[model samples]
Target chain A: MHRIALQTLLFHRAKVAAALAGVAFATALMIIQIGLYEGLRSRASVLVNRLGGDLWIMAAGTSMVDDSELLATGAELPARAHPCVTSVRPAIVAWVPYRTPAGARHTLQLVGSDLRTAGPTHAYVPWSFAEGLPQDLLAQDRVAIDDGDLSRLGLAPPLVGSTLEIAERRVEVRGVTTGIRNVSLIPMVFADVETARTLAGAAPDGATYWLVDLADGSCGPSVARAIERDPRLDVMTREELASVTEEHVVTESGAGAALAFVALLGLVVGTVIVGQTLLSLVREHHKELGMLRAVGASRSELAQFVAWLSAFVAAMGGALGVILALLVQSGLGGRSVELHYGPGAILTGLAAVLVMCTVAGAASLASVLRLDVVKVLQ
Target chain B: MTDERGASANVLEARGVVFTHGTPPLETRVLHGVDLDIAPGELTVLMGPSGSGKTTLISILAGLLRPTRGRVVLGGSEISAMDDAEVTAVRRRTLGFVFQAFHLFPALTATDNVAEVLALSGTPIRVAREKARALLTRFGLEARLDHRPGELSAGQRQRVAIARAIVTSPRLVIADEPTVALDGPTAASVMELLREYVSAGTSVVLVTHDVRLVRASDRVVALEDGRVAYDGRGLAANPHGAPSGHDIHPPTPRSSEPVAGPEGA
Candidate 1:
């Protein structure tokens, strides 16, 4: 029976190929859409993911990092007094409008950390220079721009030393960093606390987020609970803040719903195409199936054969889809848009494709089972 | 007619079989009180005209269809009383079927199609293939073992179908117009193969309108208007044995006359 299933698929190479293509296309579409959604969510929380913090202290009702207002100066004083609080640094996060050399105006997410913070590399704004050393941003009025933002910022490659007017302040691009992008595709600029404040026109003591590092072996949840006791502030652990930010950008902003619809459409289209193709194949072989029945094939045997064929199609199609998705990912590399194909996404896409193929097979099997051997034999 | 070798030797028996078709408002009776007994080592050809219910009776006898009334017994099991699954099991284990269309799985090689039967019966694939190869080799299809049905000649395709049927070593082989699509020489060859199976103690029940098969059969059962017009050894030409005789059972009295029609027409 297994051999029969394989032979049937091979015998109708054209039909099987078409069916597999449909499944592959659908799977690829799903992978791309879901990857885009995940990319968006990742972008929404990229800053939080990079900033190693036990807790983030923000102004009350700050749903996302982008929309957060400046926390009052010395807002970390209360958290710093707690036993679990080891140290706290005022991290300034603000979007500053910049006019490019091409005269195109755009908003850039400016992140400011003290840069001297010790411990893990993520203890401060995590920026890796693509063109120049991290110390380049230490120069007065200098900031680092992501390499991905070169075209958007109207700057050419090796953007180091390029100067732009941000918030009426003259700032030189001292280094080009990579992999620092937000959901808006806006370039992210990293600078010292003084430079960020100057770019955002904030007071010397103002900061948007207080990046809190807890003492070793300290519990973040307990520290966060102690900090949130103050009604003037909202405190969240790093993971909690990342989740909130992602949720704010994805679900609250309607992007999640739209992407979900596209993914569903892909599934429906794939199922219909594959299902119809398989059904047609079965119909074309109706006489043979009838003959099988006449020669003593049970209904279960026929169903199992179809299932095996469907699984084969799905497995092959899923592999093709993954390859195509990787190609798409490679094509989009070095661009402002981010497409993520993590292991989770790949496994999910494969599972969905297998399910779709199984559904198609079962639909075709229903027709096969209903076939009247007596009529078909005639 | 009763089997001279006794009931146990009878591979198939039908008693007072009546089959009908359609809803009550348009009910049509096809077979009326038909009875038959097929014994081992004999080739019985069911002869009838087009619309004479030969196929329906054959289906009932082969356990492919249930008669509206009356029972059919195959190899001591009352198949007509069995459920669909049970009948299917019986067909799979005890019966082999050859059809007019040579319904071989088109995608499978000649050997694979034959091997499918053995595989279904739980034989390991390698052994099944070897058995299938040997059987086809015996049927002079050794060179065409790997050829698909589309690549085979009509006669070779029928031979594959025959091989598929007998691969499981079934007790009875039922054929419906098995040679209708073949040339004279090929048809003769197919019948010769079937005769060989019968010689090995397997019973064969075949349905055909071809008179050429009449001379080769061990017995001939002729049906007309659904009822068995004749049940005996050799071709009788007429139901009553005379070449030009009238109806064997005088027409039923007008008040008791039963209506008859083709089963699938």
Candidate 2:
């Protein structure tokens, strides 16, 4: 039976190739759409994921990391007084319009923090720099722009020492960072706390988040709960914030739903194409199947043969789709939307292909079972 | 027919078989109370025109279709009383069939076609292929063993089909117009092979329209309208002996003397 299945597929090379092509196209489409969705979710929560804070204190009603409601300057005073709290640093997040040398204006998110603070919360900022030292932002009116944002900022490579106007204050680009892209394509500029405060024209006490660090052996969840007792603030661990941000972006925004619909369409298209092809193959060989029955081949054995054929097509198509997706990702080279093919995405694609193939095989098997051996022989 | 001890020597027997087609208002009776027997080591030819129930009777005897009434016994087992799976198992183990179309799997080579039967019967693939190759070589298909059905001539394809049918060495071989699709020489060659199997103690029931097969057959059963018109031995003895309508009586032997003819003409 195995030999028969393989021979049947090999003998009808043209038909097999067409079926494989259909499956491959569908798999590629599904992978790309899901990959884009994952990429978007990952980027949407990039800052929350990268920030090394045991807990974040935000203004009440703040749902995502990008929600820019300012907390009072003394909001961290209560969290700092807790026995588990080790230190508290004020981090300011503000989106401000910057004017390039040519007078082209673009809105860029500004992250303000004191880089000299030797703690986990400040560690991620220095390590993220791709071209220059994080200490360079300490220079007067100095800031760093992400490598992906050079064009958006109307600046080119060799961007160090380039001057831009933000909130009517001239700031020097001192460093470049990579992998800091956001789904909104908004450029990010990292600046010192004082420079950001002066540029945004905010009072010295105004801040967006209070980055909290816990003492050794201190439980983060307990401390977060203790701090949440204050009614005017919302306290969350870094992981919780990342999770909430991802959920908020994926569900509240329509982009995720659109991508999910495309992926589902791909699954349906693949199943139909492969099922129709296999059904046609079975019909063409109806007489042969009848002869097999007359020669004592059981129905289960015939079904097994069809399943083997379906598996072969699916395996080939799956491999091809993965390769095609990787090639497309590489070709894009982070120019537009990012393509993230993480392990979760790959496994989901594989499982979808498996289900599609199994359904198609079962559909054709039903047709085979209904064939009348005596009538076909006649 | 029975021996002196009143014991049946036949390998297959049909008693009071009736077949009908279609539903009540459109019902058509094709076979009406037909009875026949095929003895061991003899070639029996079933002769009839189109729609004369020759194919219908063959299907019932082979267990491919159930008769509307009556029983068919093969090798002392009442096949008509068996369920479909049981009938299929019996056919797989005891009966071999060769059709007029020579239905060889188009994707398989000649050797594989023969080997398929052995494989289906649980023979290991390597051993099955070896046996298939040896059998095809005996049939003068050694050079064509690797050729697919589309690459083979009509006679070669028929030979392949014959080899496949006999690969498992069944007790009975049923052939329906096995030579109808071949030329004169090829047809004669195919018949010669069937005769060889008959001589080896295998019962052969051949359905055909060719008059030339009459001389080679040990018994001839002719049907006109759903019933036997003639049942006898030797074309010369039963020339123009077929009645115009149905005959229910058992045909009697004309004489004990054997008829003479060319053995392989």
Candidate 3:
């Protein structure tokens, strides 16, 4: 039966090729759409995700990293007093006016962290620097910008040492990072807490959020609850904060619903195309199928043959589809809407393609099982 | 009534076999009450005009159709009473078939086409191919073993189909117009091959209108208006095997014309 399945599919090269191509196109579409959605979610929570913390304390009702009121003075006191707390770092995140070198005005998100309190790799600091070091931002009036934002910031490549103004205060670009993007298209600028406070007209002790690290034996949920006692502050574990931020952004932007619809459309269209092709192939080979039945092949045996054929198509087409999606992702590098086709996305796409092919194969198999052997013999 | 060989010796028996198309008022009867017995080691040719129900009878006998009434017993199993799967199993174990269309798998080589049946019956593919190779070689197809159906001539394709039919060494071989599409020489060759299988204790039921082939058969059962019009050992006998009245002779040399009505039901 396996031999028959393989030989018959190979014999109908044109039809098989068309099915494969349809499956590949559909799989790629699904992967790419899912990758884009993941990318969007990741970017929406990029700041909170990259900052090394087990828990976060912020002003009450703060929904995301960028939209938060300044925490009341000494909001970190409750978290620091807890025995499970190792350290609490005050960080400043605020939107500030930017004046490009071309005299064009724009708004940039300013993130302020004290690098002296933690190391460059495992702190509330962004990594993947294209040039310069995290310590450079610690210098007074120095800031870091993502290389991806250079064009929109009106700054060219080799951005290190380039000067720009934030809130009418001149700040030198001391470090450039890669892959740090905001879905809102707002350029993110990193600086020390003092510079960010002075530029954003915030008081020296004001902080938008307090990032908390826990001791090895501590549970984040317990510590978060312990700190949430203060009525003016809300606390969340890092994972919870990331999830909430992602959900908030997706809901606010409406991109999730739109992308899901497109992905669903791809699935339906792919299923229809592959299903119709297999049905037509079955019709074309009706005589052969009838002969098999007339010669003593049971319904299950015929179904197994169809299943094997569908499996082959799904496996091969899914693999090709993933590769194509990766190629597309690579091509879109540094673009505004980056795509991330990780292992999860690839597996999901393959599963969808397999289901599509199975549905198609079963439709054709029904026709085969209902074959009229006597009529065919005549 | 049993012949000299007795009913116990029969390889197949069709008792009051009847078949109808459609249902209720829309029904059209194709076979009334077909009673027949086929003994092993002889070639039986089913003859009839168009709409005479020869095809329907052969279909029922092959277990490809369920008779509306009565039962068909083949090789000790009542196939007409069996479910489709059970009848399929019986066909696999005891029956072979050669159709006018040859129905060979177009993608497979001649050897693989013949090997598929043995494989279907649980023989290892390697062993099945070996057996198929031997059978086709015996049938003078060794040179064309690797050729697909499209690459083979009509005579060669028929020979391949024949090889595929008998590779499993079934007890009965049913064929419908097996040589109707062949020339005199090709048809004769095919007949000779089937006769050889018959001599080896495989009963053959052939549905054909070819006069030369009919005259060569050991028995002829002629159908008319969905009933057996004549059943005899030789065409020279009268209808119903009585030695007296009008005799059934072979169709004239222009045998392309059917023996009775137009060809097929």
lDDT of 2 by residue, A148-230 (tens): 87777788878888888998788888888876776667888887776777776667866788888888535777776766777
lDDT (C-alpha) at residue A81 in model 1: 84
lDDT for B160 (candidate 3)? 94
Off by over 4 Å in 2: A118-122, A126-128, A216-222, B1-9, B234-265
Candidate 1 per-residue lDDT, tens place, B4-25, comes to 7654557887888999999798
* Per-residue lDDT over B1-265 for candidate 2, one digit per residue giving the tens place of the 0 to 100 score: 6778897667888999999999899999999988888888878888888888998898888888899999998766788999887887888887888888888878889999899888988999999999999999999999999999999999999999999888888778888899899999999899888888888988888899997887677777777788876665634235453322222123333224322312211
The CAPRI class of candidate 2 is: medium
Candidate 2: TM-score of chain A is 0.94
- Per-model fnat list: 0.67, 0.33, 0.61
The residue-by-residue lDDT of candidate 1 on A189-263, one tens digit each, is 889787887887777878888888888636777777777777879988888889999999999999999988988
Task: Residues B97-149, candidate 3: write the lDDT tens digits.
Answer: 89999998888899999999889999999999999999999999999999999
lDDT of 3 by residue, A60-123 (tens): 8888887877777878887788888888887888899999888999999888876778574446
TM-score of model 1 vs. true structure: 0.92
In model 3, which regions exceed 4 Å deviation?
A: A82-84, A120-122, A216-230, B1-7, B234-265
Model 3 TM-score on a 0 to 1 scale:
0.91
| Error at A84, model 1, angstroms | 2.3
lDDT of 1: 0.82
Q: Tell me how candidate 2 scores on lDDT.
A: 0.80
Q: What TM-score does chain B of candidate 3 reach?
A: 0.86
Q: What is the lDDT of residue A130 in candidate 2?
A: 79
TM-score of each: 0.92, 0.91, 0.91
